[model samples]
Target: MISQVVIDKVLSKAQETASHSWEYGTVFEALLEYRDPHYSIFHDPFPGGKIPELTVEGVEALRYVKPFIQTNSARLCEGNGSSSDPTSLCIPALLLYNSTTSQAPDNPYLSAVNRQLHDLLSTTPRYSNGAISHRDAYPSLWADFVYMVPPALAYHGVFTSDIGMVKESVRQCQLYCEVLSTSKGYWRHIVNAEGTGSVKSDDGAWCTSNAWAAAGMARVLATLRKSQYGSETADEQKMLLNMTKGILDGAIEADTDASGLLRNYLDNETWFPEVAGTALMAATAFRMALLEPGTFGERYVGWATCKLESVSRYIDEETGVAAPVVNSLKEGQRTPLNGINPEGQAFVVLLYAAWRDRRTVAEDASVPMAGTDASRT
Candidate 1:
């Protein structure tokens, strides 16, 4: 019973919020309307620097709605590679054109993008068991980047006809689960990289940053299903599925009000429900439900739908703006109804797109699978 009409309406609203990221022709640039006043950094210019996180979400939004826009392999690769990270949003968008890239492997654009992805996996620093070192500025393994970058590398294994990358993606997930999860299995904010410190405890499980892991896992599962590598047969895939279930189960248990919205920190007594984290969790549930309906997907879909209802209260009807999205754990204060961040806007797009895609499949079992639509644009 998913309505295309409602999907269209929701997509329009989210795109309005996310459109600014592309408007200035750079991943780092944010539109005037969506800017947060608390941070002076968003306005700073990056001539060719990376905003791998924002790029990942932006690239995903493009894939969801703009499937038809990528006719040229080189052009599509260039557009998506906003300073590539393995979990760079560019991976999904660019990989969508794998068929096209194969047609022109010698194209300099394809070569460069492909080289960038390859170089990341080959050279990126890692700790024991393959978790990426998140401290570009210092030494630490950010739980957020665990989901942000590695999944793309794993999916890259699929895009380039490699199964090893898929295994690598799962290993990273296992390391992330080991490092970031609570004893009860909920996500925590950050963990010291293997070399950074001996402290094994996560700094704290801030809701939104860990939500990045949920969203990343959801996408990794979706991408794995598309590969010829028999993703289901892999040991890594099974571990990932189990970990995902654990994370969601913990989230449900911690829903203090049973009201769909999750608290900001799992261990603390804060009563506030975080907007971006809620949306990410909902998206994760809906996506997992789509991935495996009998194995807790249905329950997740319900959780996602309920959580989305609570989150929608924060989004403005007229402007399509979502307020009170805490920008980052370090910089963002949970000021309810304050300014919006571009990532928050992107998550709105992601929530609608993920829910719609999964629900459409649920309601119409015969509809073509997600990546197979010949005329999807």
Candidate 2:
């Protein structure tokens, strides 16, 4: 488990990076002090905003993002544009709702955003069209992006007591799983409705994508257990268990480094110092091991702890920034992307929070089989 102090430091740095960038309510790819932050709705925005920003960052970020969602939602609703990529519109709405949930009862903005996301997702045919198109788009195939949208949707559904949204969220996740999985139980990095490609590209079997899948499945299962779908339904439980096993198996088979930390790409031997992907995998795997210590239990726990320790060594104590790794391959060589990317930082924060939560439960001996500990793993 990590201490509150450590989590606070990381959040502070991430918030600082976010503040310097475009205040569009979305997360950015990187925040170079010398350059402008690169923002994107598909892959960059952190689902959860940092605390300091929520309290003091004012409504600048939220306000900037508000119009984007409203305009997109109106366009989709009016049938003038495509809602094929629901996440771009859905995620920001979810974030705004989360921001206002604790305060401001009856927040019209949050309510409107939620309604728009629900409406678009419900009416969109591409979700269940059973055809593969838009392969290059992040929402169309990237595993992490697919892994992210559902939780936000499911969370809002539960908060608003909308069973339909909850069901749709599960359906979306199931569809993603079906499209992304290979015969070997490993999910392809690049996915589409037709099939998943086995060839490792320049990116390799991305660690973050797999981690996101693992964490997302775990969250979905937990939510279902609490919902109308309980453990009595063996099929649902089995699906969750199978997804967990698949993720663990993939991580073990894909780890190319002997140092216990996972490689960014399986075929590429380069080491990038960025902590986003690797740290997320470690944290997610560690949480899973604690929750269900069966079969691959020891391996998940041991590898996760080791990887976390290894990553900790690379963090620049003075800057709180995790350095990026540069690939040496001619085709992939480029300056490593750096600064505190919000999406990356969000994973870091969630890991610490989950670790701490688990630790507290463990000390009290009240943790379940899949319990989380907030203390150091």
Candidate 3:
């Protein structure tokens, strides 16, 4: 676990710096930062997306995104204006999670997320076999979509007592494992949703997208522990067990750096280290360490701590700014460490929250598994 000192001084400072520094910020960025949203301020002017998008099934994935119209220009809930895009689903789910649970009256956010989840039951463009559509633009199944929407639903399900929602979240994670993963091995970036693509893209194993997949799996484990999902069936137990083992074991093999940080693309030749993905790996592995057993679980906790330390280079002592996070990765091209990538903001904060919560949970083992160790605040 990370120290309380680091959480207060380092992580807090870094997150504060990021809110000021990041550019091209969107609601997706805010969703990750969606902790303790002051409604009066959220109602006031803020920079976030307001456009609704459609899924391939023509379902308005952002159909429920509402404006905090008490003040103009503070469009709190917006997503890509495409048909039923999975990537856009995270924003609405988060908005609902933020608004409905508080002393604040249940806003449209919950109803919106609930609608999208229902539409997802039959729509969302699954391959004939069953992996959810990554994006409408891609004909292939993307591993990145694992984190695009599922974790949001996982939390929503647990909070709302909606067992079906929880099951769907886990089912999506399993589908990814079945269609995109290699047993006893690491995952590939893109699979043939239509079964047409080659085994490897020039992009190779993208670090953050892979991190998203692992995080999504870890999220299901976390959710089940927190909610009344009931004792896992033999199959459920095996699935979670395999997902936790596979993700951690594979990442350990690929993290070939002195800093104990991961490269941008795990199997690519250049081997550039990036912050967002490594932080995500730390979050997922550390979270899993608590639930899993024996040496396997213990190793994850240690590995996560080391990786968090590795990224300390990106955080400056004077300003606490985390920088040099890669903007994005492409099939044959590599993006430079541009501005503070929003992904860096999202995962780094999440990593801090996860580590901080573990210490609290450890002290009170009596706290139910359904309780989240990681809070946005």
Candidate 4:
């Protein structure tokens, strides 16, 4: 398990940074940070069994993210123009808060929650095939959208017992996979199928983009498994599992750097080694190991462990910022070696939370198997 001190420093630094320090700023940063608490509390390894309490770090994470949730909930309730970007990533956090806290019948957040759901389902631009557009003007797909959009839908769906929302989440992933990924084990960064304008596409397999896609799918699978539809949707769950594994396989294989970290562009050797993507990729692998022990158990655990150790070396001892990351705002360029990357810090927190969860589950499995008399010794 990672030290609590290290996790604290990383999350604290990320929360203190400028709102625009990350590509999507407070919304993305808060969403990622909120997962540490949400996953610890909700993702039960044993569905019908007891779950553990939140770790100290998880409690602190909730505290850090609550303010953002409150503010965003209020802002959205004020009737902000319909969202067109990944701002919906923050909706899950608001949903979490609203459901857990006591509220009046006329609670403004109720409107906020309903408003976001309306915008996402009825207003967001989409390709003809039903993939949500990351931009408002054109029908384009971004690997990052997988993380921002689907998990919120799944979480909301499960929260409200609306199986249709959950199904839509799965459908979005299928559409994205059809356009952005290849069975050959890589997902392109972006695709613009129509509306020629200033819209751009990146054919490269950007490492962080793949990490976003994998981690997003992992969250969706976990949510589905814990939902009322878990049994009925086994086939869809399997598809999500396979899709996540394929992305991880390609990312691990693309680690051509002597440092054992993936490059900014997985296939482009000229690009610098990137710790943000490395951390998120490793985080996703740990998630896969936890979700499907039979398939990714030893295979992903070994690779993810080694990559995590490599990632740790890149985090600053004093400030907790992970360096040598690609500038999220300018995905084509590298951040200065000395500069701090907000998303990089958040990914480290995610990596450690996932490692801790898997480690706890592994320890639990050390007991006797179901039919064993080993307990009689």
Evaluated with lDDT, which candidate comes out highest? 4
Model 3 C-alpha lDDT per residue in residues 1-377, reported as the tens digit of each score = 43434434544443334321111122233333233222111121122321122231222212212222111111222323212343334444444345323214544444555555555544456766666665443344667666655665665665565777767777877877777676535577776544444544322567777777887676566556544554643466467668757866888788887655687777764766777778887877766655553434446776777887877666655544455566653433465465545456557766776565454565675643322333211
Q: Look at candidate 1 and give me any clashing residue pairs.
A: 56-89, 87-149, 188-205, 189-204, 189-205, 289-297
Candidate 2's TM-score: 0.67
TM-score of each prediction: 0.70, 0.67, 0.69, 0.84
Our tally of clashes for model 2 stands at 18
Ten consecutive residues with minimal summed lDDT in candidate 2?
Answer: 29-38
Prediction RMSDs, each to the true structure? 10.4, 8.3, 9.4, 5.1
Query: Each prediction's Cα lDDT score?
Result: 0.53, 0.49, 0.54, 0.69
Candidate 4 lDDT trough over 10 residues, lowest sum: 368-377
Model 2, position 77: C-alpha lDDT score? 23
Clashing pairs in 4: none
Write the residue-wise lDDT of candidate 2 on 1-377 in tens digits. Answer: 44445555665565555431111222311121001211211121222322111321344334444544553333212222333233434444544555643356664546555555655455443523432222322125545544445655555565565666666666666666777666555565644433334433322455556666776666655555444434443465467668767866777666667654566654346744346666666666755654455543556666666667766665566555554532211214335554445545545655554454444545675544332333332
Query: Judged by lDDT against the true structure, how good is candidate 2?
Result: 0.49
The runs of at least 3 residues in candidate 1 whose Cα sits more than 4 Å from the true structure, single-residue gaps closed, are 1-87, 92-106, 137-139, 194-202, 257-260, 329-337, 365-377
lDDT of 4: 0.69
The digit string of per-residue lDDT tens for model 1 on 248-353 reads 7877777775444676665565545667677777767766765666575445666678787777776666566665566543433545535555566556555765
- Order of candidate numbers by lDDT, starting with the best: 4, 3, 1, 2
Model 4 per-residue lDDT tens digits across residues 1-377? 44668777877777776353123333244334345444431354223332222332334443554444333433332222224333443443443344334244654554565665676567767888888876655677888777767777876776666888888888898899999996658799989876667767898999888998998898789878877778977888988988888899888778779988899999788888888899999988887776776677666788899989998888777777777887776888654446777777778878887787666656664743211232211
The reply for model 3, stretches above 4 Å from the true place, is 1-107, 137-139, 156-162, 195-203, 232-234, 329-332, 362-377
